[model samples]
Target: MPTYAIGDIQGCELELQRLLERLKFDPAADRLWFTGDLVNRGPGSLGVLRLVHSLDACAIVVLGNHDLHLLALAAGNERHARKSTLDEVLSAPDRDELLHWLRHRPLLHHDAAKGYTLIHAGLAPQWTLGVAQTLARELEETLRGAHWQDFLLAMYGDQPERWRPDLTGIERLRFITNALTRLRYCTTDGALALKEKRPLASAPKGLVPWFQCPGRKSRDARIIFGHWSALGYWDQDNVWGIDSGCLWGGNLTAVRVRKSKPIEPVHLPCEGYLTPGESGD
Candidate 1:
């Protein structure tokens, strides 16, 4: 059985089909670990969300920032639609079911037997893989709990600028969302600079990409993430970035966990996105 860990699909559903065909993926034999943001940017947000929801047994997904935003917008946390990419998802006939599935997705997934951990973005500098997973569990449970709407309400900001386990309510949820999904740069003091999605040297005066930060807690674990399309295909010993910006006229990317260093990536042409908005990579 071949398990393929794919980067952010972000509403590019047909590419997923083509890539799977290239790999000869059998739903019964192969499993898929998605790094999240399965619906957004691209044109098939509704279809992708609906399909992933049905692939419950064969697919595992972590919640990406866009995914969280979709939940918040769906639950009426955001008054107006944030962007054009999400309008389709919000207005879909089965919006409720799609939002339910998205909100209930996990924050992180780790396969010990396979030696790879999957997150929508990358990990924080101060957290070990174990600690990251622990925090992820808290957020996942909170999202899945009855008061999930309350969490969604507080899930949109980046005010605190740090992490504290004692944080309750929406502040905690927001932090988790950023750290696990929207994260890109970090401060020298280990603060999250979620707004900047740019790469290392071009980042602000005092920021480094979280995965490259020295003394990073989750640095030891092999991470597979799909958020930074600009980061492209960084291949360090422990981190594998798979976002090739398929929605932005780039090719879809997928990496086999066990075969991280292998032949050319199976590329699929982009179906293009609905709009040319700011990329979440």
Candidate 2:
């Protein structure tokens, strides 16, 4: 059974279909690992969500920032961002089902056999494969509860510029969500810098990519993630970034995780949105 790890869909539904066709994906014989951002920023958010939700095949999906934003907005905590492209989903008849399914999705997934860990963004430098899974559970439990909106409301911001084990209550939970979904560069001390989504070379002085932190303790494990569209389809054998930015007219990409050195991608071109004279369908 082959496993394909796909990048951020960002609501590019037609693009997703093209990608699967290119890969010759067989639902009955293969597995799909989605790096999340499955909705928003394209013309087909509702369609993409519906398709993935009904796959019935084995799939591992972690929550991306766009996915989380939809959850918070659905819960009436925040308005959709001006830059958001989620109107189709917001108006969908099955929006409730989609939102709930997303909330309960895992924050990180690990496969011992393949030595692959998948998250929306990437792991913190300090977390072991063990500690990352533990904290993911801590946040996941609250997300599955009534207090979820409260946690989402508190999930923004980049204060404290450092991580501390003593961080309690919503603060700690919020930190985990941000790190797993929105994180890019971090202070030398492991504090997340969620606002900067630029490429690695352009980061502010003293800040380091979360995966490249000094004395990186967890870099030993292979990780696959999608975020930071700036990073594009970069593959480092052990670290795979599949976020090729379909919403920005880049290709949709996926990688077979169990492969050996120099990972290669199964990629697809972006599909056009409905033009003024054409129907979206």
Candidate 3:
């Protein structure tokens, strides 16, 4: 099967459509793996959600930070939605169904046959593939269960920036969520520096991109992620980052992946929907 991994859409629905056209996407045979942040920042978030949700079995998505924020808003966490461009999604007639579908999406997707894992952002340097999968399932179950609203309530925070096996309750889940969604830089000892969103070269002292940190446990497994538009389309250290800043007037990008072969980026320039600093991802 032909598989394509696409970057953060961030409400650039038209760019998404055009990129799909460029790939000659065939719903019958081509599989799409989306690197999340499906809504927010750009215009047409509602349209983007509808289109991706309609893809059904042809697509697999991992939730990004903005996606989680949307769920929080859907659950009445309005404070975080103040600067969001997701009003259209909230007001849509099919809001409940769409939100329900989105909330249930996984935080991480692994394709064992292809030897690549998909996530919205980078994993913690401490987690092996097995441990990462286990952590992902923990959050996935909470998001899909009866107490999902509670999860959304406790989901927003940046505390306990480091991961530990003994960490319990919301602190543990929060760290896992941040590492998988909002992560950018980390200290030498693997303490997450979530606030540092600058490019790798300008990263604060003693910090490096999460993938470049030494002694990473999942280094042997390939990781494909988005959520770092500033990092652009990076392919090093067995990690592939495809977020090309579509919401900020950069191109929407996708990489065609075939087992044991180098991936190639397919891109189309976006007619930007929002300027940088106007909204947060």
Candidate 4:
């Protein structure tokens, strides 16, 4: 079976549909992997959610920051930001069902046989693949458990900039969530520089892309991630960054992933949704 790992959809359902058509996606014979950010800041988040939710059997999704934000809003822990395009989803008749499904999605997915690890954003330099998986589950259990609301309420923060085994409680969980869903740059010593969002060439001298941090523990694992539209469609050093700025009128990308062959990326152009120079996830 062919497997396609797609970048952030961000609610651009029409583009998603066209891209799937371009690939001639056959649900019975092919698999789809989403890099997350499947909703928000686009015109069709409601439609996107329903469509992906309907394809549950054939689609694998890791939660993105936007996805988590939606859950927080639904749980009444956050107010919609000024550019929020999630009202449709929040008001949808099937909102509860959709949110439930999204909340249960994993933060990371690793296919040992295929040698691919998927996440919505970057991993901390301190975590090996095994360690990342274990940490993911710790937060996953909380999101899927009864106190999910409390977790969401406490989720927003930039503290605990580095990881330590001794870290416990909400601090630990927030770090995990930020590492897997918001990380972009970090110091050589593994302190997350969450504010750095510029492209590689323009990055400040001291910050290195998380994947390039010296002695990264997950260096040996092949990782696929999104949430860095500024970095766009990168492929190097055992990692793939495929966000491609779909929400900003760049392209929606999908890469055919194979165990022993060069992956092929397919791109579909998008009409600009939000104007340029606006802040977005």
For model 1, state the Cα shift of residue 147 in Å.
0.9
Model 4 spans > 4 angstroms off: none
Candidate 2: pairs in clash: none
lDDT of 1 by residue, 1-281 (tens): 77877877888888887888887888888888888888777878788888878887899988887788788786668643556478877777887877777777888998898778889887778788898998899898988889888877767767667877687767776787788988888887888988887655577788888887778877668888888877777777478788877887776887766644452355676756643445344
- Candidate closer to the true structure by lDDT (higher is better), 3 or 4: 4
lDDT of 4 at 98: 94
Tell me the tens digit of each residue's lDDT in model 4 across 205-268: 8899999999999999999999999898999979999999988999999999899998899989
Instruction: Write one digit per residue (lDDT tens) for candidate 3, span 42-87.
Output: 7778999999999999999999999999999988787776778898
- Please state the error at residue 152 of candidate 4 in Å: 0.4
Give the alpha-carbon lDDT of every model: 0.78, 0.80, 0.90, 0.92
Clashes of each: 0, 0, 0, 0
| Among all candidates shown, the one with the greatest lDDT | 4
- True-vs-predicted CA distance for residue 237, candidate 1, Å: 4.9
Clashing pairs in 1: none
Q: In model 1, which regions exceed 4 Å deviation?
A: 259-264, 274-281
**Candidate 2 residue runs with Cα over 4 Å from true position:** 259-262, 271-281
Q: Report the error of model 4 at residue 116, Å.
A: 0.3
* Colliding residue pairs in candidate 3: none
lDDT at position 178, candidate 4: 95
